[model samples]
Target: MTAEIDRRSILQVIGIGGGIAFLAGCGAGRTEPAQTEGTSAGISFRDQQGRTITFERPVTSVVTIPMPAASLLVAVDGGADHLAAMHNASWVAMRDGILGTMFPQALELPHEIATQDFTPNVESVRALNPDVVIQWSDAQLVAPLENAGLKVIGLVNNGKQEDVDAWIAMFSAMLGKPERATEIKDHSDRELAEVKELAAGRSGPGPSILYFNRFVGGLKAAAAKTYNDFYIKLIGGSNPATGEDPLPGTGMVGLDVEQVLSWDPEVILLGNFDGAMPQDVYDDPVWKNVAAVRSRRVYKVPLGGYRWDPPGQESPLMWHWLGDIAFPQEQSGLRGKTTDYYRMLYNYRPTNADLDRILWTEQNRQSADYQQFNAG
Candidate 1:
């Protein structure tokens, strides 16, 4: 939290150390933060923090300090025209992830607005002259930015499915696209429901799944009540990581080597946050006896507009990816859904190679049931 990621490298630094070291609870922000006033014509509304913000006219420019907000802004606004500046971590998400492909101009935008821990770079953000600043609701984070007289749209996400809806609604309203917000919600609802419906069909207890937000520094698992665990349980899978103590506000907990062996999850998922990959786990003798490793069922979560491990615009896709392996019996259209999702949201379809990259095909091809994701 004390460090500042250098802005020159184009996403070399991630806010939580690497891939969203922070929790999505493993789902999208569960509720909406910013709300539109009266009708489509209203200019006043409350943010998730319940603070009222009234714009004299339309919002023409925005500075986003939260990591996911930048890509989300591009997604709801359908372009990069309104974004003035973003956090360095946000830049890494797009430049290294699929959002960069959808909006290349975003890659060139200024990302010196905040430090790695989301401390607002008041001078830089002020110079950007944005109409409003979108940031997290943490008092420590929001106080300085607000103290500078910046009209901040502070967001609070609880990692619920409604959180993603609220984000789409908030961004759409900010963009003056009420219809677009409805479209985004409908799409999210349809897909999320589809995954849930299919997951409900399975009768038996699903495989024991474990997700590691970070693996190299030590073992960190997505504990219960987090977005990560939410999706795991939502998809009918069991999370052995729940019930243990979690680091407050972060939504994950640390575990000793013996603790992991005790759970011995049937399927292991490597988060995009850390440098650890399938090979790292495969090579580690400590994990060899684990059921997931023995069965070769470990996988690296996919990264789309935002890291799939945490909630973002592409969260439903994360569910399908999990279903592809954990419930291999299902005819999960991993490829088609991704292609269709991109087309529906960005109006740009991905090629087979692009889908392959998003799904980590090259790295996960050898994992058990991974072939289920192949273009069939």
Candidate 2:
């Protein structure tokens, strides 16, 4: 069942912002420590913006402004010990979800720094006295933090698999744990290889998927070049909205009810952001005619240490789960793989109840535990 298609080649062909080639290995060489005033050790790497950044010493104390970045920090560092502060969103997920279940100590860490919306409070961050600040690669955001005399590193996780690998490598180097980075990358590569094999077994075109983000004024769908869109492609699912142009900068497009009906996707995946659930879609009159709803093929994307739909350390596990959802007959061992992943990475074997919560299964949807977990 091994895929004849080279995974890296396929990724480049479908890469966002045109085909950016996947690097063969970690780029940006390291250099000897120079006599810089503040830096104890010298390390350099290329960031997502293709800018080279050098650190004086290993980033021991960190403030991750973005929720996803917090997850990455904890994962690559092998624990939450180095995290001085993190976005509130990651803290919430950690408290009520599998993160807390695995690493209860993370609950004790200070996560009061308010930067979940990408707006950093300099006073609040300065109080934490972090050695480095990790956030999304936005110049405007980086400038003010620099002005405040804080060392900041920018990262972009736009759903490209190669980029995720690069991030693991870059963060590992920054944390002075190149061995850990290699371990993480090797695990991810192995998992992706498994997914490719499963995808190769499928006969016809994969299921037509629509990743519904929210139901605000209209249906906001993940468009081409978006993270969710890239995930769909990675898992061998076809996005019905691919032909439509993405919204400027954001990579999400708004689709009216009629347009969604016209696309009539075979499978619908609800994003974990908004509180919208499968019941809402099933109950809506306009949505009733959609093929996915009519066939009972709509599913809620799982949320664990982080949202499975986003770019994070849990992406390998995400690929396994999505592969099962996309081709259950061929990739039916998601639970076993999930068990191995949690045990290996988080050092906690999830209970049956935890699996239900993480998977967002129908049984979980009917239970009070799920309600309480979401309410928190």
Candidate 3:
């Protein structure tokens, strides 16, 4: 909760006050006037599933059943003032990370809409009287909420870079905050462009990386065309798990020790799920032969406002961090970029220790703070 200047500077550069005027001057003929606070014409737009939805008026109250939906809403809507309730996953992620630190008021909101397994409770959602409900594109889950007479907007979050722009556009239109959406989109575009430019300077193929969450049940990796694979490609690294068929609807494919050894990835990125630590990988005898472990290139993905593995507001930050890790010789300005993003978006100026906490690695997993954050 310390980076107001960074946020102000972003606004100043974007000319936020004149953003609408600039759009008007673009000469892009529109079919309808943009929705505003009290427009009688109401709001209408197509959601991610290609369903046309029209509202009688601008939405002031919202309930999000998916964690990413809440994260995107918070980014475009500024804070959680409009959120009536959220999924339990979103509640926990926000409570323990930069989102809660910056917007403590969000902690006071109710989170009784769904359970950890994503089972929605209709009665609990009805009690909140939300203007709309945002969730995944699952028909069965969404049908019940719609039957309860709530406006339901379905989004398919596949974690691609394109999904980021789509979320910004969808939420901006729904909340009647096009200006904020433009600002967020512009910021993401600028950061990603810089990272892409850095990648262009590389003379050879990037390192091979494998991103996985758990190793107990089986080795599940982010396969090609999935959300996590999108990040791997963005960082200029290649995913060895690509081309293999992913588990149905899960976007992950199974791997065995022998298969992993064959791929011989130079880097391994452990997802910040289930309190996984890099030490867990290093200690396993079967993994000792992997090139990543031998070279000490294994690292834990960072978790800030949200987990970096998925498409959320903090994705651009992840791009910068991964680029620097993959090719340090290019100097991707990782620290400066991370500091600016935290200040501008989360309104929190990270101290050196705070940076360490956000970018928790295997070396610091035993610290009291890291333990507390992952204790859940």
Candidate 4:
């Protein structure tokens, strides 16, 4: 068992901030170092943030700070045996999703290495003696851990589909299992190509869909360069929020009731980052008049190994789910595809009830489009 660190007690003195310390490997168009006897020989790879990371010893244990990195590791490495600690949100996602059931040890791993917003708790991280820590590119988040003598493989904080692919590629390379990433990418590529063909065949432009990034405290919609925007456009749907500009340091923009009313999207998507649901949209008096709410087009994004909303291993599934809703004419067997994916990735087939939970079948059952995904 890993020793527990007093995370709350140590933060005051630990002094944390962010920066990636480049250890070894070529820099910007430089030639790869020749394999020499005395130096330039170790586990070396460039992280997604384009920083080169090299370790003299094998990475037997890892601390994944980014929310989805932990699950990505489990998928790429084929188990959670190498995980030392992960972010709290990552732990929660695992606990609630199928990964926790498949790799129970991960649920017991500590999440005290980083705080709620991914700030590194330097002392807490040091206690675990992880071989490497997967971190984000935020300077405040990476600097502190580097100062504490931890090696960070920095990844960018973005929701693009390529970013998800980059994560799989980077992690699999780091684990000395590059083939795993190739397999994952191949599956994703095949599905993405299929979805694109379906989109091209659609007769008219798809419905206008609005993605609520946050609806509990205030309304924020995904717009421009977000992964939501990528898929919304891919599935033949147009983002009504395309013109809504995002404020600095975020990918989404703010809105109010009247603003949303003006757009009057044909479909509304509630993200998995919060607890807001389709029922919440349906129950709201002010929202009752909206075309999507009135038509029961609002839906809560599904959660499987991770929340299928943002970006992760199950994006192909998310694309199909969204496509089915926005263009039911092209609906396929999502339940069977999900079963096949699980068998290939986790080596375990989900039960009908598991599929229901993963697909949000019960909560979304009211929507006619959701019935096609039901297992039973």
User: Positional deviation of 190 in candidate 1, in angstroms?
Assistant: 1.1
Q: Global lDDT of each model?
A: 0.73, 0.68, 0.67, 0.76
- Where model 4 places Cα greater than 4 Å from the true spot, the runs are 1-41, 244-250
Q: Write model 1 residue lDDT over 65-176, tens digit each, in one string.
A: 8777887887778788898888887888788788888888888889877777788889898878788999887888888878888888876555456556656656665565
RMSD of each: 8.7, 8.5, 8.2, 8.6
Tens-digit per-residue lDDT, 1-376, candidate 4: 0001111100000101221112222223232442211223344556644456665644779999888789888888878899899998899888887788889999999987777778888898899998899988777778898998888987763455656776776676567665676789889989999999999987788999899878999888886557787899888898877745333333677778898888888999998777888888798899988899888899888899888877788889989999999987677688888888888777888999889999888888776578888765
Off by over 4 Å in 3: 1-40, 243-250, 361-376
RMSD of 4: 8.6
Give TM-scores for every candidate, taking all chains together and pairing residue i with residue i: 0.87, 0.81, 0.81, 0.86
lDDT of 2 at 240: 79
Residue 237's lDDT in candidate 3: 90
lDDT of 1 at 109: 88
State candidate 4's TM-score: 0.86
Q: For model 3, name the residue pairs that clash.
A: none
* Candidate 1 vs candidate 4, lDDT winner: 4
Name the best candidate (by lDDT).
Answer: 4
lDDT of predicted model 1:
0.73
